[model samples]
Target: MNILQLSNRLGYPPKDGGAIGIYNYTKAYHDLGHDVTVLAMNTKKHFYSLSQLPDSYKSLAKINAINVDSSVSVLGALMNLFSTESYHISRFISKDYDEELKALLQNKEYDIVHLDGLHLSPYVETIRQHSKAKVAMRAHNVEYMIWERVAMNGSIWPKSAYLKLLAKRLKKYEAQRLNVYDMLVAITPEDSKIFKEDGCNIPVTVCPAGLDLDQYKVDKTKIESMSLFHLGALDWVPNQQGIKWFLSEVWPKVNSKFPELKFYIAGRNMPKNLLNMNLQNVEVVGEVESAIDFMNSKSIMLVPLLSGSGMRIKIIEGLALEKSIVTTSIGAEGINYEDGKNLLIANNPDEFVTQIERLIADREMVNDLGANARKLIENEYSNFKLVESLVEEYKKMIV
Candidate 1:
């Protein structure tokens, strides 16, 4: 089956959370012997550019490189007073890409048109209007909820207030358009429920975020340190808020107990505050080549995510690498890991400190939890299993 996979950003090297999910997913479908092509816009906000895509990508799959304008509009700026969060604007949804996509559909009939992010939904409607393809949308997280979380942050006040208003508007817009697609893929059951509550009429299924286990194999011989690692794209609002919350409330508690605990932070585009806050025991290493390698070296992974939707690939990656994880309930969203069994769930600073102390003091507990976590990921959350479900859904949609 020929699959026209649409993505908000180019999916090579899969740096960010969303990109990583799509990249692995499409690869799995490709492995399943489906003829897959990706049509993506170049957001250009991240590390890689169009040059990152090799000749093979162009030959194997139709890769569309549309340069979209993501700047805030004047109306968006005014909306900021009520809600600082703004919907990402893309001027690159050109008639050219639409015609190109339509032409592809006209030439080679596709069984499924899988749209990756909500940001790419606008184009899905365009495709539906012109092409005879079954449309399915994979909701990473309800964009409105993401905006609500962004607006609810205490770190950035005026911006948060503005985002709150934007969230409401986006919620209404998205809710109205939810039924247009044939199928809706939610990253979590919780998100699926939210979608239903918002009147999404399409068939909703829980499709948790995945990790490339091959890239995250456990290394038993490596000497692990008394270090804690937290990684996310720093530019992302959730990561920014999570780190701040950790630095202010959680990390200080952990530090007060274990001053010698080395806290290593790694992610894309570290903000100035987080970078400058690099203290005696804190190391802010922004953007590493291999996040799994970094996870293997750490004794425990700390995910103090407070406001975020969707499953955390960071937690799953840690599990796959046999790193014991300590995270907030929000951080462990959609992951089927049992708290105190495969992972330690902590919401408050005290709870976080207690978990960290337990993990630090007991080697056996850490080993057991880490091992169980890896087992859970291998059995349930593998990319192979995820793509299988996706394939089944595609067949249903087509039938």
Candidate 2:
């Protein structure tokens, strides 16, 4: 089957969740002998040259990228209030991207035209005009739900009000585009239910991010005995909010309790405030050469997400690397994880501290949790299995 995947960014060097999701699925589909071509946005926020990708990866599919500056501006955000369109979605609407997509569609026929994220929904009409392919929208997250959660978690009322405004418009935009796709490939079953509840007339499937286990190898020897870490895209509001909460409320207490234990934070776009922090034993690792290597080196994984939707790919990756993880309910939302059995789930600051301490004190429990977590990922999140199942679903839509 021929598959044309439209992405908002490049998935190679899958440092973050969004890139990991896009890259793994494409690789898995290609591995299954499917012709998969990705036309990526290559946004300035997450830019990468195609030349940087390995030759083996380049051979996987006809990977093409277009420069798209989907950055936010103070002027643009204020002007958005005068219009009915969603500011969040409108930022990705590029004429160049549309024209490139149009040209690609006209030149090469595809059985399926996959919209990787909700941000790409604006290009649906251009796709409709040029391609006879069955269009499928990969609902990475409920965009409005994420904004709502961010607003709820926010402290400043003025900023929260603006976020609420974005949420309102985003919700309306989601409802308006409900039936535009042939199917909605949701990242979680809960996400699928939410789409249906919000008047999604089309078919929605639960297709969580699948991991290629071969690419993820656990090194128990590398893990530091008294180390704790949090890794994710820091530029994202939910991540930044969660980190601030963890640092201000939770980190101090944890540090006081276990003065010997070290906390390492790693991810892209580390804020200036976090970088200038003068905390004890807290290493603000802005970005790393390898995410897996960083995860393997840490004894415990910390995901104190206050607000965000969709599956947390980092948790899955962490679990795969056999890192005993302590995350909030929001962090472990989509994964079929047994709390306390696989990974510990802690909601508030106290609970987070307790869980982290528990893992630190009990070496046996940590081993057990990591073992179970790895097993859960092995059984449930197989990339090859997920790709084959999704392809079968796509066949139905095309037929």
Candidate 3:
């Protein structure tokens, strides 16, 4: 089977959750002997030089990247305020990318044109027009839900109103094009249900972000038994919001309770405020060389996401690495986690403090949770196994 994967950003390094999803799926598809071609948008936010990528990775697909400046501007945001179009989706529309895609479609024959996320929805019609392939969209999140949650929790005045407006527009935009793709692959059954309730007429499959377990290896030697760490793309609004909320509401009490315990925050594009916060017992290691390495070294993984949709890829990786994790319900969305078994859930700051304290005191409980976490990933979220579901769906679509 020949498949073309259209990514919104760089996938090789898989810096963010979205990229990790794309990267894992693509690799799995390739390993399964599918002729996968990756045509990714090298956007300003996740720009990477193709030359920097290794031959081993390049061999997996006929890799191609087009420079797409999918950057938000003040004027564009203001213009969107008047228009009904979603500023979130509109930023990805690029003439350069479209032209390149047009040429690529004309040259190669693919059985499936896989859209990585909502960001690539704009190209569905173009793909339909140029090729005979069935279009399949991977919905990483209920796109509008993220903004709606952000707006609900927003503190600022005009910004909150503006966020609400964006959410409304995005919801409409999503609804209008529900049946555009031949099939919809949701990251969770919960998202699939929402799509069905919201009038998605296309075939929807519950396909969570599956991890390639080989990449995650737990080095028990490096594990810090008394430390806590949070790793994610810091540039993302939800991550920044989560970190801020954690510092203001959750961390203070926990720090006071356990003064010797250190909290390390690491990710790409660290916000200036977070980097310069100078919080005691907190190490702001902005960006690390490898996400898996950083995660392995930490004692407890913290995912304090207040508002974000989609499966937390890092959480899956952490689980695979046998790490004891504590995250809010929102942060733990899409993944099936037992509160006491696989990972601990803490919705509020107090709960977070309690969970952290619990883990710190009981080594046996931490080990039990970590082992259960690895078992969960092994049983359900293995990419080697999950890819078969997606492939079967694609085969059906093609037939």
Q: Pick the candidate with the highest lDDT.
A: 2
* Candidate 3 residue-wise lDDT, 153-186, digit = tens: 7448888998989999999998888899999998
Q: What's the number of clashes in each of the models? A: 5, 0, 0
lDDT of 1 by residue, 92-141 (tens): 34565666667777777778898887776677766776677888888888
**Candidate 3: residue 179 Cα off by (Å):** 0.4
Best to worst by lDDT, what's the order? 2, 3, 1
Model 2, 1-399: lDDT tens digits are: 899999999888788999988888789889989998999988889899877889877888899999998899999999998998899999999999999999999999999998899998999999899989999999989889999999998558788898999999999999999899999999899999999999998888888888999989988786788699999999999999999999999999999999988999999999999999989999999999999998988899999999999999999999998889999999898898889999999999899999988987899998899899999989999988987898899999988
Instruction: State TM-scores per candidate.
Output: 0.92, 0.98, 0.98
Pick by lDDT: 2 or 3, better one: 2
Q: Which portions of model 2 show Cα errors greater than 4 Å?
A: none
Model 1 lDDT, residue 10, Cα: 73
CA lDDT, every model vs. true structure = 0.78, 0.91, 0.90
Single out the weakest 10-residue window by summed lDDT for candidate 1: 84-93
- Candidate 3 yields a Cα-based lDDT of 0.90
Prediction 1 TM-score vs. true: 0.92
lDDT for residue 389 in candidate 3, whole number 0-100: 76
